[model samples]
Target: MPAPDLDLRLVRCFTTVAEHLHLGRAALALHTTQPALSRQISRLERQVGARLLDRSPRGTALTEAGRVFLPRALALLDSAAEAVAGARAVGRDRITVGYGVNLIVTPAVAELRRRHPGADVRARHVEWDRVRSSLLERRVDAVVARLPLDDDGLRVVVLREEPRALLVPTGHRLADRRSVTLDDVADEPMPRVPDERWNAFWRVDPRPGGGPAPDGPLVESAEDKAELVASGQAVAIVPGGEHLRRVRPGLVAVPLEGVEPSRVALATRAGERGPLVAEFRELAATHLVG
Candidate 1:
């Protein structure tokens, strides 16, 4: 028998539903009504020839088939995004560079346009965890990512270095300190990153004199981390960016002493530097350095 034709839209609907686990919440997230979302998922179940989710009186739960298909579904979505980006790349003079909220790439983006004139240079504000994958998946040609990025198979150019700061609740013990050392918060649990590689980076691993960090609740975004700080659950060591300072008033960032500053860089896939990507990266480097 021939394989089923999976619709990307249905897959997206399924994934969003899977993430929320509530039809109304998922519909609200997808900007659609619950009935509309239900129709889409029903269509998806027919296409897959299996019930992916089991709706129960208590709530919705994924069926065994869904547990198996979730990861593959996400991978397929990433592949579809890459395909769309690839199609857009062909016969076009455009490049998309994703950056975190902390690192401001606007100045670099403006300079790239000044240098390239007619070529399209766009910027995307990506979440912290999605930075590296954005580059790898071709969703963006390049990214302005923080330092200690794995250099195994990627090209990275350091743009600038900035001090790291500790974000704590306004009323926390260390909030009034002029500056803090890693030793001061050595015992305080820090927010966690799901990816081990990022877990260390955000946590500022290798404490003073090479100590292990105390673990805290999982955090995946600035807002999430801020909540942890405000709730006195955890603290965050982050790049000292003005944007970070302005996002949450409940949290206060004090400069972290006795540690190296964070490095911001322009990263691209190794040996895959098309002209537009190269030009944008060069402009970013020169502008930031100058």
Candidate 2:
């Protein structure tokens, strides 16, 4: 026959009595009557085949067995409390996800809502670097970012890969090319975007020897960068994703010649949490494709 299980109620009853050294006081601590507490302790002692405490004229004192096992009982109580808190952390009325600094409002985000109508899906945009921190601190369960992140313990999935293009002014020499090489644009004027903002673009100094930096104007915001390219005053690098499909005639996109292209990936912490986190991961798998 299998041995009887260790009961939590017995641990609690023992701990209370151990601390108070009196049945009545321990019962009060547990919000139970003294007779009930006594019965619980008796059962615990019988299961262990040892007396936990000795009753004398003055009060109860810990027996040798109780002294030996008190620390383990205390550990059990602490573990129970922690287990409950961990479970509560994953439950929520609605799921909040970090959209990162990029767009998650595409068709896939819409589909997630349709699948989980009862769950409220709200979003907040943050810097790409902050995505992992947000997940670790519980600010958001998951985030969408350009993946292959350097986070020590995070998970990433390739969501989408769009062709990258060089955005040049209409009259620029490279603009006339059916396709242009990164070397052809080496001497062309370029503008700078915030390091944080341009992280998604695969345009990180693709030339050899850091050859002769272009003496170009610096521009903030992709819109201004696009405008600079359109005005023919400067050329900017751009990802030829759906976002760029709306380019006007003043701006022309030509593929980079002889250079390997790059793609974007979605990232999040590993392991399962709430339903929302799972849903977002699934959304990335379906929407983000190479």
For all candidates in order, the CA lDDT equals 0.82, 0.69
> What digit string (tens of lDDT, one per residue) describes model 2 on residues 206-241?
345555436456664556777877887777666666
- Could you tell me every candidate's TM-score relative to the true structure? 0.72, 0.56
User: Model 1 — which ten-residue stretch has the worst lDDT?
Assistant: 240-249
Model 2, residue 196: what's the lDDT?
Answer: 32
Alpha-carbon runs more than 4 Å astray in model 2? 1-90, 98-105, 126-139, 147-153, 194-202, 209-215, 270-272
Question: lDDT tens string, model 1, 46-78?
Answer: 999999998866878999999999999999998
Candidate 2 local distance difference test against the native: 0.69
